[model samples]
Target: MQGHTPTPVFSVRDKRNLLFIILGLVPAAALAFWLHILPVFQGLYLSLFRWSGLSPKRKFVGLANFRALANDSLVWKALGHDVYMVVFRLTAVIVLALLFAGILHFSSRRKQKIVQGLFFFPNVLSVAVVGIIFTFIYNPSIGALNAILTNLGLENLTQAWLGNPKTAFPAVLFPTVWGAVGYQMLLLFAGMSSIPKAYTEVALLEGATRIQEFFQVTLPLLRNVVKTCVSLVVINTLNRTFIFIRVMTKGGPNDATEVLGNYMFYQGFENFKFGYATSIAVINFTLALVLTFVVTRLLKKENLEYA
Candidate 1:
């Protein structure tokens, strides 16, 4: 007893397991702190100060930047545009993806794989690349779209799609919709695949058509997946507006297509209003957080169990 240690409560294996668990958590904790947590706090701090991102001194301007943002009609308009874009994106992504996913669900296994790959192809590319490709497609004079319109004798329909403020928002949004729908379809199909076919069979046996079966049985079973897709769509609509807007229109035809992300970029890098930009970033983050919270709560379930 004098020289030997007392009996340990945990065996060597338990202690070793605990050590491994702690070791596993250390890297993740460090990454979360460094990559996400610290940056958010730093952005908040910088938002209260005027720094061009180059100056040695950061002049503390208090809430002036945020106040300016609040008063700016353009900023408000940009916020409105963000909402509009999200609404459109959310609707289009869901309707199209869900429809196609349903179709793919019933397809033969071989055909399903081929068509699914085609649908998912767009999602694999970077948003900027898609934007660039679509930019060419929308070109009025020699673009493929205009050529098709001309060939079909619908020349009036083809204009400078990205140049006219009236057409710019929809034009830019088209590519985004094209790129986003596929991934959501994939998710929905995956969810559908997990569903037990017995439910569908039972519904069918009870005089349920394919449509009826989908509505009564499939949709209910896929609730969690649908909820998840909705959340992802909301999030994507918020944050993923950046690369598309930047590459395609650059928040142009006279700010008609301006969304929060590009507007923030225009403020920070182009205008050198880093403080103002940081304020925009803060507001963007806050709005995204609030919306994401609402979505999660709205989709929250008592239990996923279906027996």
Candidate 2:
């Protein structure tokens, strides 16, 4: 009798609920595969060949393209530039956005709204337009940047920002970081806004300075948000680097600004090396996947008690 308590069983209602859940997931899973997973497989398959744009023969070279890519010095150089961008862009966006978000989050509602909109305005425009505008802004002759520098008696600092190999990479990256700040700031600000007001009040009651409260209380609570922002920045920079480089520098200034995206385009379309280009795509996708996984593991959240 003591052992007679029957194990809980899935009732008819429970089974019906499970059935509905499975039904709902079917289309979503199918869509994900069709849209995202299928393309990756297709690209990987295409990368193993030696096909020009017109060739129906589809000569299978079997990893030759990847082998060539390994030996390609230009590819390595482009990758090095991308790695540099990852560090610089993340640093500029995160630090600047965090500082501005703190300012806005603590400001009055009207002031915060006006300034936040101004900050995020750049994101609403097409990237091409922003690039075009900045191209003019960086123009050495009549550009606003040089004009301001000249007027400030820093004429020595004014140079061909986009044409000089030493300055071209940073020139291209500056626009990216500038446009990204608003979005990242807004994201971090939202996370800050969500922090329980009681926590701040308690910290203040304990005679903590504003800086102490921020470091100990606000930032700790926003750890997950910061991680998410970093991940998004990584993804956005990787994808958008092609467009920025193409429109602004076209990987010029002696290829100082070459990155994966534009370089892949040049190989596939301009050079008509489709197979080689797809190999580059495979590398790009793999690099992105690996970085995202590592970042997720590194930023893994703990069971912090928050009420």
Candidate 3:
């Protein structure tokens, strides 16, 4: 055994495989650090200071931004708007997507693809485009919505949807739900397709109605997929509603449509309160992370087993 190296716990081949795996992951890890992780840390660091982000002047005012945000009424109201959107979007999208997914799941293969495409078409357009299109539709002077109402002799129902605080947020929610439901529907449909037909057939054989089977069998089995969809919707509603709101309302009509993301943008770019905006961004990110974690844990389930 003289001059011999001890046998490694991992054989050469195993070590080679491990090396390859590490190499494969290195690029992705580096890219993530450069793109996502680095900016997050930068934002957090910037949040502790007062900076206009237009000059080299960065006054280190630790936690002042956070304190300011805590006392700011608009921040709280904006977050409340986000919560409202999360709740409304979660309810409307899930219900409608699930309903449509169920219908698509049971339809003929050819017809299902066509209908699914039609539903998903909206998702293909940029969010700004959808917002702009809806803006025209809601234009009181000559918008399609009011024009159609007038033609139908329902002129009393017409209002400047985006200009009225009472209707602005709800009108915004309509397009938000419409644009999102299709993708979630397709996700749920795929989940439904993965379930064994035997489970459904067995339920039917036992004289279970379709509704009973869905509730007792399909929905229970689709829990994991539904959980994913819920988390996605929550995160998107919290972090990505800015574009739609910006294009449509600009958080206007007395700030009734203000949400966290839009508020962050308004402060950072419009008001030159970059530090305050970064703090809001931090809060937005935290809220999304916490809510997603809470939702996932709430929906945690044991894996389904089949004999």
After superposition on all C-alphas, the RMSD of every candidate to the true structure, in Å, is 4.5, 5.1, 4.4
TM-score, every prediction? 0.88, 0.87, 0.89
lDDT of 1 by residue, 1-307 (tens): 3676545643335677678768898899999999989988988998999888887888999999899999998889888898788778878998899999999988999988998889889999988789989999999877898899999999888899999999999999998999888899999999998888887899999999999898878987888888789889888888887679999989999999988899889989999888899899888877777776876787676645565
Residue 108 in candidate 2, Cα distance off native in Å: 0.6
The model with the greater lDDT, 1 or 3, is 3
**Residues 263-300, model 2: lDDT tens digits:** 89999999999999999888877777777677667777
Q: Which of candidates 2 and 3 is the stronger one according to TM-score?
A: 3
Window of ten residues with lowest summed lDDT in model 3: 4-13
What's the TM for model 2? 0.87
Q: What is the lDDT of candidate 1?
A: 0.87
Model 2, stretches more than 4 Å misplaced?
1-37, 301-307
**By lDDT, highest first, what's the ranking?**
3, 2, 1
Global CA lDDT computed for model 2 = 0.87
Report lDDT per candidate.
0.87, 0.87, 0.90
Candidate 3 versus truth, CA RMSD in Å, comes to: 4.4
> What C-alpha lDDT, on a 0 to 100 scale, does residue 59 get in candidate 2?
91
Number of the top-ranking candidate, with TM-score as the measure: 3
